[model samples]
Target: MSPATAVVLCALAWTVFLGAHLALNGRWWPWLAVSLLPPPLFAAAPLALLLAAAASGSVPGAVLAAGCLLAGWRQSGVNSRAVRRSSPERAGIRVVSWNTQHWNQGREPDRFYAFLHSLPADIYLLQEYLNGFEGGEVWDIDDEERLRREFPGHHLSVDNNSVTLSRFPPAGPPVPVGACSLRVDVRTPDGILSTYNVHIPVQLTVMNPLSRAFFQDMRRRHGARRREYDALVADLLANPHPFLVSGDFNTSAAIGDIRRMPRAAHDAIGANRSLFPASWHARWRLRLWRIDWVFTSAGVRAEQYTFRDPGGLSDHLAQDVTITTTAIEEMNR
Candidate 1:
């Protein structure tokens, strides 16, 4: 192929790949199924294309490739490179958020429990508190007794599929949010904090993309995902106390759902420093997608944030965050 022709193909390839993530992104039908793939895969396509074109020594192709990358970067999700640390004297609450896929049933139960014991978090927001899928069918799991026995000091709040075990006593009973999420008002040393443990439904299951069933299921799942996001957004708006929300949102940095959150909401990961800090599909060393997140309202600040490897126990990494009150006015009633 001619060098010029090769460059054009490379640019077009990148354009289509970037367009999918920028435009489709699980927001619509058939294309929604395509979006299930990690967005980083799309974001990285331009880089690969750029290298191929540049190797051809085609200046225009290299320039066009660079432009595509810039566009991808602009639309890419938030990531922070700068580490924010708290003052030694400042008291911060350590919150650990994790989606224990099928709980301990899928892994060695003792090791799973031991991993949980190692985290020195004040509050634990856990999801997928259900039994492992058996031949594609999932059943409820009753681990409340075991959880209580394992973590003696914390109070447990169990909603549908998520659990909130807090060392801080409950200020009130757990509020009904939705089937995929749980909210609890807890009394903290700083003040009453509204904490949400969420597990938003995935957009689509892996299947034959060209099949009619795939699109149909994608549409149904999209609708369900929207309703869940709407419920969570509504609660976040009406909540009066300083809040923290953490979970498997089943959303990427590129999705509109996370953007639908309150304008004042701050990411627990702090300011955007890195481009892709993925937390799911742990087997992939690159960790292409960040489906799990930790977000806090205006009054709260995340002093430290980190994602812990689950040691093949689950598909997602655990989010460990240290949050402190930024303003007395916001935390106090």
Candidate 2:
């Protein structure tokens, strides 16, 4: 094929690929298209297309590459090349949200727990945080008696699939509602901090099954998750305290309007306008999707946002967030 023709095909291919991510969800044919394209192909196809086209001496290749890069950069949301760092302007409260995938005491227990202890976070809220309290005893890190020895005096609540470990006491116990959400209010020196930790499972077992039943189930899961998000937003609105909602959203942040994530809250990750740090796997261990998220309400803003490397145990990368009191007067109240 002529270089010109090849470049044109390449541009069209990249355009279609980008369009698919923006438009498709777990429905029918589009679902297949979106899911079938593996994460590697999703990330690399456009780059490959651009390079092959540029080598072909086709001017269109440059234009297509520019468009492709621009689109990607926008989706990435990163403004500056340098990652933002913690600042004193922030309220001196460091919060880390992680979906530990229940591996705080797995193969690398020492490393995991050590890393956990090292974070300077005043609070650590986790999803998929499991520590059974069956025998009239509360346990963390696999119920080791040492937990009491190690954490001493630090407040911890590990109930439901969601957990919160903080320096100060939360106003009450976690409120679990809908299918997979936990709400809590932390009484910080600044004010009451309303926080919600949500986990929206993607129904992986039925997502790709050939049976029509599974296909229908996939759609229902989407509908159900949508409702859960709506209800969570409503709850966040009713909260009297300064608030933030962080979670394993399951769906991509690029689908913002569909998720209808709170307009009043600033999506901390997006608000930082930082680089795309994939929170989920693409292959044996490749990071590809930034599904884990953090959002803060009007009076609060993130001073810095950073993530841990994907620990071998969990599919998610832990997010360390430093939030500031944008409205000092409100926080004083």
Candidate 3:
């Protein structure tokens, strides 16, 4: 094929991607697809260069490249100022949330133990941590006993897929909110701090092959997740203390409902950091996406945020957010 023909083909493909990016961020329902397949927009620069090289006066290609550039910047969170390395005073609380990929036995126990020891978070919220407990809906006592003996003084979900490990003991037993959400308040210097760690079901897949069943599945999953979001938010909001709702939402911030946190909570990473931190890997560190999140109340300010090793043990990346509520207390003082 001629270089011009190749450039023409690349330009067409780039145009389609550019259009998809623009359409995906729209408030309309179709934009939901963008939330799932966000990484494709990154191809804009290379394609634009190819187009420009093949044809010096390629107006359509130029426009497509420009749009792609704009979208890429926004998606990359270039303007995000939410993440930092350390807290303003280093006295803020550090919270870590990771989907530990079921903490499969013997998968990466040595590394996992090292991670647990090295994590600086005062509070740890882990999802998909399993202990091989499966028998007639009964939690395996052996598994539960092992974790209790190893990591005692924490409220854990044996049946569900989430766990909350705090430096301080829970004020009381964990209160069940719903399917995979539990609330546990801890005593802090400022006051009581409540955390609702949830594991929501996965959202509609955009990468799936396009078919009638795809649309139906998307709608079904979206509807179910929407209800769960509403319910989880309501339950968390009704509780006492300045709270944070965190864990894997399985939905990207590109979705309206996903962006709408319970009680107007702020996304610690999204608000403070401007860089796109994809938190999940599909196959062998490929197909990355940010489905895990941490949301804090207005009173709690996230001073810093960072992602754990992407290619680490779990398919999901760990989210470490160092936050301070001292600002609120200081203001009150």
Candidate 4:
């Protein structure tokens, strides 16, 4: 093949791949195919194509590269600010959300307990409170006595695998929202704050994407994930109290699940200035996908939002958010 022909072919392939990332939406078979793929592909693939186009003097390749750049920017959720304001409002309540993989069951028990003690938060919305998975099955982890001893005065609420430890008083009992989330209401100084601690089902359990079984499992898991999103959205829509949803969603920013979240609530990470703010896969320290997130209702604003390293305690980074109620809402309450 001629050099020009080869360049054209490569550019066309890259364009199709990049376009797929931008065009696909919702929990469906088409989206499932590329959902688990890393965000880094969005960056690297386009840059490589742009360089090839520059070397070959291909206008069409350059145009495609521009499209890819736009796709990357949109998919990465980059905001205008370089970084959000670091100083948290004194009146805001600080919340620390993390998916501690079978809390304190892993290698360093001392470090894990110490790290939990160190986070400066009034409320802790923690997921994966179970013991680590054994033989593809989950085992319970009962740390109630120990947690009471450690946290001292905090109110503890446990629903299935999710847990919420709060310094405030409990406004109501824990409510399970489907199998993906645990809803707990706490009466803070401002008013009642409804919090949902979520851990959505992981996508594509049957790993090998090339096989028929993989596609079948993908379809099943996608449907399950969609149901979880719908259930939570429905609950949020009907909720009267100002709410905060925080946990390991197991869904990335690039996918449709994030879009399925209620429009009434604002993404806490939206305030982040960095283009690629990742929270999962801390082992490699690549921080490629941000599967964990925190969202707040209209009246509740995030004064400060950030992702902190788990310090080798878990595979996911910790999300620390300081949220405060609007004055109008506080007065009405």
Per-residue lDDT tens digits for candidate 3, residues 57-89, read 655556556656565554442324544443354
Off by over 4 Å in 1: 1-9, 16-21, 48-67, 74-91, 106-108, 271-276, 283-286, 330-333
As for candidate 2, its clashing pairs are none
- Those runs of model 3 whose alpha carbons end farther than 4 Å from true positions after fitting are 1-34, 39-79, 82-89, 105-111, 131-142, 153-159, 204-213, 270-274, 282-287, 310-312, 327-333
lDDT of 1: 0.78
Q: On TM-score, who's better, 2 or 3?
A: 2
Candidate 4 regions exceeding 4 Å error are: 1-11, 23-25, 77-80, 83-91, 107-110, 206-212, 273-275, 329-333
When sorted by lDDT, best at the front, the candidate numbers are 1, 4, 2, 3
For each candidate, what TM-score against the reference? 0.84, 0.72, 0.70, 0.86
Residue-level lDDT tens digits of model 4 in 25-93:
564565865756665666666778778878888878777877777766545544435454555345678
Per-residue C-alpha lDDT of model 2 across residues 233-306, encoded as one tens digit per residue: 77766666788778787756344322466567666764343455666762236566677788887677787777
The predictions' CA RMSDs to the true structure, in order, are 3.5, 5.6, 5.7, 3.2
Pairwise lDDT winner, candidates 3 and 4: 4
lDDT of 1 by residue, 1-333 (tens): 897678778787777777665676646555555555556554466777777776787777777788887776634553534444434534589899999988988578899989898897899999988885632678887888989999899999998788899999999999867668999999887788899998888877778978888778888888888888889888888888889999999888666567667775677665323446778887667676788988888778877777889888888999888888744555322
Query: What TM-score number comes out for model 3?
Result: 0.70
Window of ten residues with lowest summed lDDT in model 1: 78-87
For candidate 2, which ten residues in a row score worst on lDDT? Answer: 131-140
Best by TM-score: 4
